[model samples]
Target: MGNTDIFLDKYKQLENCAINEFKLPPDGSAVAKLEKRSEFKDIKYELNYCREVRNLLQHNQKLDDEFPVEPSNKMIELLDTVIDRIKNPVRCIDVAILDRNLIWRSYEDRVLPTIKLMNEKNISHIPILKDRRVVGDFSDNCVFPFLLGDDNCHIDENTRFKDLKQYLDLEAHPSEVFKFIPADSKLSYAEKLYEEARNRHERIGLVFLTANGRSDERILGILTAWLIIGQ
Candidate 1:
């Protein structure tokens, strides 16, 4: 009926989330399950604190004298937020689906589709994959000079991916413009990589999402500044 009641209700909801939603082990008590779940490894102490407080709420039929029976709205809000995040951890694949910029094409495929993808999607940076791996990045900025200049040879939209190889510099700067991470990575992990690259003052034009977060892993998705920033 009061703030404390509301707080207790929220804690129940959180426990339900742990069991049904996150699928924490049902072998022991809720506290045991919270501690056992590897997903809470990063915040075990915080979880312990919540368990302690929730325990007091459950066992202590206290007079309002022992503790603040009425927790401040801000306190409840903050704790709820932590529980919510624990319930719903964001993975890189979750961010991947948000990007309409994913335009994967093989080097042997036609270049026209790449151009159309750029215009329609309003995207410039792209990964050119060969045999399910990213070979290089492609963009109008890199390919435009050839189109603008009066090159002796004429290539049209029908020109396949190989044709652009002649004009576009496919050489990737090793220090700049990408790194790979698995789809299961947390968004924060990806942001950390981006930050590290920026701190090194590298170009960091794109981040290639792969199945296992390795050079040999199959490309699953791509990440750009906007997609990460927007989230």
Candidate 2:
């Protein structure tokens, strides 16, 4: 027989079996005319639990004569949905070059107009340069050395900002503290640089001080983790 014929025959058999258990109309037209409002509403939870029980029985799990199945909205949400927002975060990452003309100083000497420039431009960390060479990466807190009694805590106009020449060239303390991350580095590597700064327990801020690693260590940019995320 055709698929439709076979389906109709099975449907008739099911209707006969159900009619044997309940008082069903004998006339096909009377049965088709029967109208009843559905009593069940919002039974998806129960249906899902019953499906799970059926699966457990098929899998040969413990099948008791009578068992209770509890459904949790929390587990349903977890298993049914892809939580991408929690697993992955969107972070804007970029780099900016440090202005070579910029100067810096402690809290003492006339407040160093560069500090005001940095504030006006929304620049948080400013690197003190002398003769196109980096002297110190100065944030708002670099003024502490001058607040104590240090008279020479100032970026003189004639001083040259030391460039990152070699790996060993960055061995100086507050004076010659030269450290930087490349602009071509990945975001994870940039994060690691900031993490290392945190682990050092020093004021050595995470400065993505950019330089041309190919030609020479030219001051191309200066950045931080905050700048990376902000980008």
TM values, all candidates? 0.60, 0.39
User: In candidate 1, what are the lDDT values of residues 1-231, reduced to their tens digit?
Assistant: 677777677777677666775566664366546665544556667667666776777787778554445555654674587567766778888878433445667778787777777889787676777776777667755566556557564557777766666444345333346678888888777777777777878666677777788967777887777877776
The TM-score of candidate 2 is: 0.39
lDDT to native, each model: 0.68, 0.41
Ten contiguous residues minimizing lDDT sum, candidate 1? 167-176
Worst 10 residues of 2 by lDDT: 31-40
- TM-score for candidate 1, please give it: 0.60
Stretches of candidate 1 off by over 4 Å are: 1-69, 72-77, 98-101, 144-155, 166-176
lDDT of 2 by residue, 1-231 (tens): 533233334334433533443367664421122112011112335434434443443344334742233334443342222122112322212345444433444223333455567788887665544444454455544444433435554544432223111211224335323356555545445555555666776444435344433213445555555665553
Model 2: lDDT of residue 43: 36
Which candidate leads the pack in TM-score? 1
lDDT score, residue 20, model 2? 47
Cα-based RMSD of candidate 1 = 8.1
